[model samples]
Target: MSTSSFALRLMDVHVSLAGHEVLHGIDLSLTAGRWSSIVGPNGAGKSTLLKAMAGLLPVTGSIFLFDQTLMAMDRKQRAQQLSWLGQNESASDDLRVWDVVMLGRMPHQDWLAAPSAKDHAVVETALQATGAWDWRERSLGQLSGGECQRVLLARAMAVQAQVMLMDEPLANLDPPHQVDWLEQVRCLTSQNTTVVSVLHEVGMALHADDLVVMQAGRVVHQGPCADAVTHRAVEAVFGKRIAIHALDGQWVAVPKF
Candidate 1:
């Protein structure tokens, strides 16, 4: 594939946390305009790998965003090209939901200048997309866990970045909201936005365009989600305790028991 066709690329990437390596020689290439879900059992280094891709952590090897070196980009340039939604993100409890989402536009704003009209429009659109617009005026402290997650999702969406990397984005969502999130992802991919997520829900991960399976800090498999080889790798990484099957023309994972 052409290098220009990749939204993100990593070469022999390695990350260490607290003096111990967590991600081992991760070489990944994420196609532009595709949704790629990363999956593995606990301690698989999924989050660490994601952080490295986002340039949030120090790494030993090369990472490229589009055709540019990730580390070489300035903070504002990186922010404009990539967005991140992390697990249990912390924002001030006193901040209104609208204000929180507006933070996403900072990278595009002039320092010390008020938000532009376009920023307001983008924030509103993101809030509506995540079903959080109704509570725009409410403070973060007033929302429940699931509600908070939606607001944070809106914040990430408001960035309108070319690439979005999310870690456990469905953390507190209900089944219906999870489906909604899936639809939102489809919409993003349709717009040619590259999405990478670390999903604990095997069934949900199967809905992605591609799957990256990791084991003990190493990537064991990467392929199209519908490929039987990908399913086998997923099951194998989980010790064959789960099985992937087709139901209603969609792949679903069920416990072996």
Candidate 2:
């Protein structure tokens, strides 16, 4: 593959959490400027895998970001290379939405320095992109769950990093907002921003450029979304006693009672 087509490479990455092993020798290469989704049932290590890619967890193997070892870089340096949004992200209720979004600029900002005009511009653009601009002046506590989630997403997008790892971004979003997020992901991909997210929505995950199907602590399948064999692998990973079909152009995973 071309250099531009390969963004991050994970070689035998294994991670443990809370005294339990979660990821088991995971190996995958994520393409740059593309959208990749990881899907699995509970206890499948989906979040753990994402965190390992972001260097948030203690991993045994090497994770390379654009041909450079992520672990070899210092914390500040890695922060400039990768942006992350965890599943249970929480913001102080008293912080203004604008300020929270501006925090994304921290990696590029000097210690104790004030926000620059360019930073303000990026924050505004990110807010508008996530449809959270109207709530910019509001406090975090004033917004609902979905609204808060959008504001946090805007914060991550404002960072403008080349690679972004988000865990459960669709958590509090409604159906319309979920569609909006898909559009945003497409826009980011076009601009050469690689995006990888862990999702519980099977049908939505099927729409990604590539799918990583994890089961237990291992990645059972990783391939293009259009591969019919991959679809069967996905169904097998979930082990759902149901039919998987295409409904109105969207992949639907329906279960039978």
Candidate 3:
């Protein structure tokens, strides 16, 4: 396939933090309109890679988003094109849920301008999609962890970006919500929005269209979820402490014991 076929492409990407190299020279190309998960042991640079792709970390080398140079894009353009949901996001409990979600529309708003009718409409849609519309008037502090996560997800959805990067998005959610999260990802990809997430939940990560297994700051494998090589890659990363198995038409990694 042509290089342009990929939605996000990296060439020799590198990152260092506090005088320690977190990512060795890494290269990856993720197909557009698909959900891909990055999975690895802790400190394997999975989150670092996700942050690099989100432009939050200063890195060397090239990152292309939809064939456009990522760093060259203007701030407003970048905001409109890419949305990021960081790990363990925190918000003021005093704020109303509706207002929190409305924050996502800030990117599309003009300087110091109030929200337009379209902004309200988009926020409403996002809230509904995340199942947080019913609690729109409630304070964030009043909601449980799972409920709060839904509101946060609605906020991210309000950005309406073509590419969404999520770091451990399943945080604070229960199993049902985790399934809902997977469904939401599928829905986004169906709408031709690219999604790349860093997840610690191996079973959940397997639900993605593709898997990017990282080990020691490098991509050890990249392929379809059902690919045998991908399964092996997952096992290898965990040092065979876990095994990937096909179960009920899905891929999951289980404890070897």
Question: All models: lDDT?
Answer: 0.96, 0.89, 0.92
The TM-score between candidate 2 and the true structure equals 0.96
Model 3 C-alpha lDDT per residue in residues 159-234, reported as the tens digit of each score: 9999999999999999988988988999999999999999999999999999999998998889998888899889
Worst 10 residues of 1 by lDDT: 84-93
Q: Which ranges in model 3 have alpha carbons more than 4 Å from their true place?
A: none
Give the per-residue lDDT digits (tens) of candidate 2, residues 1-257: 96446889988988877888888888898998889999888899999899888888889988899988988988878888799999979899999999999999999899999999999999999999999999999999999999999999999998899999999999899999999999999999999899999999888887899999899999999988878877888888777555568888877778856
Clashing pairs in 3: none
Candidate 1: the clashing residue pairs are none
lDDT of 3: 0.92
RMSD values for the candidates in order, in angstroms, are 0.6, 1.3, 0.9
Worst 10 residues of 3 by lDDT: 244-253
Cα-based TM-score, every candidate: 0.99, 0.96, 0.98
The per-prediction tally of clashing pairs is 0, 0, 0
- Number of clashing pairs, model 1? 0
Give the best candidate by lDDT: 1
